[model samples]
Structures are given as C-alpha cells and as structure tokens.
Target: MIDLFHCFGAKPAHRVDTSLAAEMLRASGCRHLAVNTHTIDQVTAGDDLPVGYDTATLGSVMALVGEELALSPVLNINHPTSAAEAVKRTRQAAQLTGIRVIKLEVLDPGFKLSVNAEVVEAARELTADGFEVWPLITPDARTFAQCVELGSTMVRVMGSPIGARRGIEPQHLEPMGEMLVDSPVPVMLDGGIGSTADVEQAFALGFQSVLVNSCLFADGTDPVTALAGFRATVDRVASGTPAAH
Candidate 1:
C-alpha cells in the first residue's frame, strides 16, 4: 500500500495539540507520523540537546499512536559540519528511538550547494549498521542517481524548500516526475503540500508516498477532515479513478 506520512510535532510552531491530531490520524486511517527532532539552527550551532530536541513533547504522542501506525523520527542533517557527524547523529537517533526507518533531512535553506555526496555516504554507513535510510533530497537527476547507487531504501524529494507553504512549483513537476519514474527506490514527495489538490498531483506524478505538514497545521484546517480527504484521494488514484476536485 502507498504510505501517507503525516508530519506531526515537527516544529514548535506546529506542535498544537498532537494528542488530538494523533486521534484524528488514527480515525482517518493515516498510518505514519514523522516527528522532527531538531531545527537546522540547533544542528548547525552544535547544540547538545535531548533526543527529540525541543520536540520532546512528542514522546507521549508517539507512544499514543502505538504499533498500528509506524513512526519515523526526522533527523535534520542539513548543517552537520562533516559527514561523520551526520552519520553519528543518524545512528544515535535510530538507536535511541528504536525505529527501523530513519528519515534524513539533508537539504535546507542555509546551504546553497548540493550535499548529495555527503548524504549518500551517510546513507551508505547507516545501511551497513542495519538501519533503513530515507534520504530527503532535492529533485535532481544526479542526486537521485547517487542515492539509488548507494542502495537507499527510499528517497524523499521536497516540492519546495522545507517549511515553505508554497506547495509544488509547476516548473518542478516535469523533472520531478521524470526522476520519480527512473528512480530505483521508491520516491516520496515532501514539504510544501498545501491542499488535497497538491496531494493528488503528487500521486499523479508517480510518487509512491507523500510527507505532509504545513497544510495539516494551517490556521483553519480541520486535521480530521484533511487527513480523511488525503486518504480518500490516495485511494482513488491508486484504483485508477480520477481524483475528486
């Protein structure tokens, strides 16, 4: 089945009542939640905070979600000074959380250049340590090729810069779609998904999964209804029916 990851408790600003969100997710048949550990600043500053960083409140939420739905802790490696640091942080987080899949956030606003090589190396090391690695990357052929070459389990391509509410840009879809078709590993669309239409478009573009956040926690968005809407849209697309407007 195509997995839909609802990113809850990813940022301090979006932490609004995760218990209610968790309940809603369960009821809506959403089976995955990706929790954000630390912000890009904390990682770049080399802060030694606790496991979940400022998002420690999510610990109870994760437990509340239980075994039916899988939980993935998103470890942001966007600002690691070195590749070794990135691998160390990923390994530590996986071991601490006991989660089999570790989502690595390598792309961020601070960095202007591509860090595909560093991220690929980290994924390689983590795989050797017996952990499934999901490297979050930009939609580029070279980056996708490297991740596939390193045997990544799944690759997450952002629709836009992380945390931006601008959804997927029209210009990005063609290249993103091409890469998705050619990628050996499953490609998940992440970031900037603002509505059910965006979700429909991602699935239409051939992404096997989607990681969403901003839209769910938006000012007036009803989490329960939104989750259900996305689930229904995915189901329809998977069955080869046209998505409902």
Candidate 2:
C-alpha cells in the first residue's frame, strides 16, 4: 500500500507548539512528519518543552513513532545561501539529530523557484553522505530526471507554487505520470494535496507518497481530524473498497 508523509511550514511562517502537534500526530496515527526550517526553531529550542521530549531533526522529513509518541521532525532545508553553506548546515543537522532523510529545497533568498548546478551539487553531497536526499523542486519532467541522475533518494514535485494549497490537476498529472513511468526512484506529490480525492488521484497515478502541509497546519483546522480522514482513505483504498475510490 502507498503510505503518505506530512510537511508543515514548508515555508517561513508562524511558530507551532511542538508538544501539542506531537500529541495530535500520535492520536491521528501519523507515522511520518516534516517541518521546514521555519518550524525547526520551535522544537529545537530545548527551553520549557514538555518533559519526555527529545529534539532530533531529520533533513526536513522525520519518521514519527506513533505508539511511543516520539516526534522525529523531518527538516525541510531551504537553500537560502550558497550551495556549500546549505550542504554544511544539513550535514551538521544530520550529525546532531541522526536524521537520514534530508529534503533539499533549492529556494533562493527571494524564495523564487530555483534549480541550478549548485542546487544539484548540494543534493549530490547529501546523497553521498548516505542521507536520503529528497529535493522539493518544481513539477517539471526535466528537473525530475535531473534529480534522479544525481542519485536522489526521492523526488518531490509541486505543480502549483509551494504553499498554494492546490491539488494535482490533470494537466499537471499527465507530465508527472510520464516522469514517473520509468523512474528508478520514488516520486512524491507536494503542494495542492488536501483531500481524499487528491489522495486517490495520487495513488492512481504512481506517486509513492503525497505531502500535506498548509492544509493540516492552517489556522482553525483540526489536524488530528484531518490526518484521521486521510488515514481512513488509505485504508479504504488499500482494502479495494470500490466505494472509496
């Protein structure tokens, strides 16, 4: 069955209560979670956090232990400066947290969509270090191939601009499908994924996983309820309960 991972604050935004979020994660049965650079500060501060909490940053994507309630934050590293600096920072985080899955978001200082040689090099370095490098890149077939060529562990794509809260539209899926048809590595659907319909569509197309960010972390939203809904959908689809599809 295809599993899903969640990403929160994939871009710079307000702070979140890591303790509360961790509670929701366990209650909702969410096994994987990611927090971008912006959200990292909240969990890593080590000041006044609830007892029994340990801070560990995985490259922007963390594997949560559901029953134990251990929150391993998956870090979404945004490349705000030179490639070397980005790589260095990631390596340091990995060393400190023992995070294996590193997501590299090649965003320039202006936050514009950027994919270049330096960005690719940073990914290569992370991969060579044995970290599972997942690049959050624009949804382009060529760029997908480029990431795979560099030996990325996973290739994450966003059809709409990141944080746009748009789903995988047909027009975007056609090319995304073509890109994954023969990919040796797994591909993920990022951005614009907020509902069961989106999950079904992603499952049908060949996405190994889908990312949920703003939809789960938005104001006034109940993340536990939302994540439960998504998990139910996964169960239904995996069971071949035709009604769900």
Candidate 3:
C-alpha cells in the first residue's frame, strides 16, 4: 500500500483545533504524521493555542494517536551552520520526545547537494548515536547512494519544487524509482502531490510513501476534514480506483 504521511506546517487563522486535529488524524487512514516544529510560530503563537498546547506537546499527542503514526522530528538545520549544535538540538529533541526518526530537508539546488553538508553531517552524527535519520534530498541516484552510506534509513525525493503542487514530474521520478526498487530502504516522495492520480502515479513508479503539507493545511479548513479528504484519495489510488478529477 502507498502510505500517506501528513506534514503539519504553518496554520492559517480559523485553523483546526488541536484536539480535533488529533482526533481526525487518528481516524484518518494515514500511515504516519510529521508534526513540524519549524512553523509553529507562524501557525500558533502564545495564547492562541489551547492550554498547555505547543509544538513540544505535539509529539506526545501524536503518540497517543496510535503506534501506526510515527512522529518525524522536523529539524531544519540548513547549510554553513554549526553541525554540532544542530546535532545536539536534534538529539535533545529526540531524547526528550521519545520519537524514533528525525526528518531533514536539504535546501540547495542541483541534482546533487553541495551546500548542506553540515546538516547532512549532523544527521550522520545523530544516526551514529542510535537515532534514525531521514533526509530529503534531490532525486539523483548517486546522491541518494551517498545518503545511504551516511546512515539514512529513508530518503525523500521532491516530486516537484517543494510547496509547488504542479503534480509529479514523472521524468525526475524515473531514476529515483529505479533506485528505490533496488534498495532495501524506503524512498518517499515529497512535494507536487495534488490528487489521487498523483499518488497512483508515484506508487507505480515505486515510491513507498507521500509527504503532504500544504494540501492538508488549507485555508479555512480543519485538519480533520482536510486529512479525511486526503485519506480518501490515498485509499482510492492505492486500491486502483480511478481518481476523481
């Protein structure tokens, strides 16, 4: 089955309530949920959140959601930064939250990453400390091979430019798909997933999971409703049911 992984980013006003968000996600058919600490300030500020509700509490809430849902530690340790500090923060967050995987996104151009070595090294350092690191990088097979060598258990390839929902760029997916087919680890697709058709297209090309953020955090929409919509589409696509629109 093609798993649906929801990424909780910045939330707009009239956003989904935390309790409802938790309930809906638990009821939804998604395999995993990635609660992003990176955008918490943009989404919810002091007094705007429910009592005792904060980004740090999200991990425990998601944990109560179910064992099926794995909370991804959103570490945005970009390039040219202190790799040790990044690793220390990531390790502290993981140790405090008791989550298993830390998700890293590379913010550089080209098919191969050149500017995010520190972030990569930090992830490597954390992995050596018994943490599972999942870094999202370009779809280049060679770069991904190096990532595997660096102790990344899962690698996410952008289906399109991040946050642009133009749908899966099938050409970019071909080599990554082939690489995923031969690798023992999971290869996930992030960005550019617009509908059920897109999910099926990616799954057929050998992606193990889809990470969605903007699609689920729609304006004036609650997480429960948005998640239900995405869950339905993911199921239909996984079951070979023709996509609607």
lDDT of 2 by residue, 1-245 (tens): 36767643443342345455565566455565553343333445322222112342332112334336545545557645566766876765565556677777766665645555556778878778877788877667777788898888788877565555567755776778778797798888776676778888787788877777667656657766777777777677777787522
What are the Cα lDDT values of the candidates? Answer: 0.64, 0.63, 0.59
Model 3 has an lDDT value of 0.59
Q: For candidate 2, report its TM-score.
A: 0.77
Cα RMSD of all models vs. native, in order, equals 4.6, 4.8, 5.4
Ranking, TM-score, top scorer first: 1, 2, 3
lDDT of 3 by residue, 77-133 (tens): 222135565566555555444656677654554322323465567667877887777
**What is residue 137's positional error in candidate 1, in angstroms?**
0.7
Task: Identify the runs in model 1 with alpha carbons over 4 angstroms from their true place.
Answer: 39-59, 67-82, 109-115
Q: For this target, which candidate reaches the highest TM-score against the unseen true structure? A: 1
How does model 1 fare in lDDT? 0.64
Q: What lDDT, from 0 to 1, does candidate 2 have?
A: 0.63
Q: Which lDDT value does model 3 have at 206?
A: 83
- The alpha-carbon lDDT assigned to residue 95 of candidate 3 equals 48
Error of 2 at 151 (Å): 1.9
Clashing pairs in 2: 60-74, 60-75, 60-76, 61-74, 61-75, 62-74, 166-192, 167-192
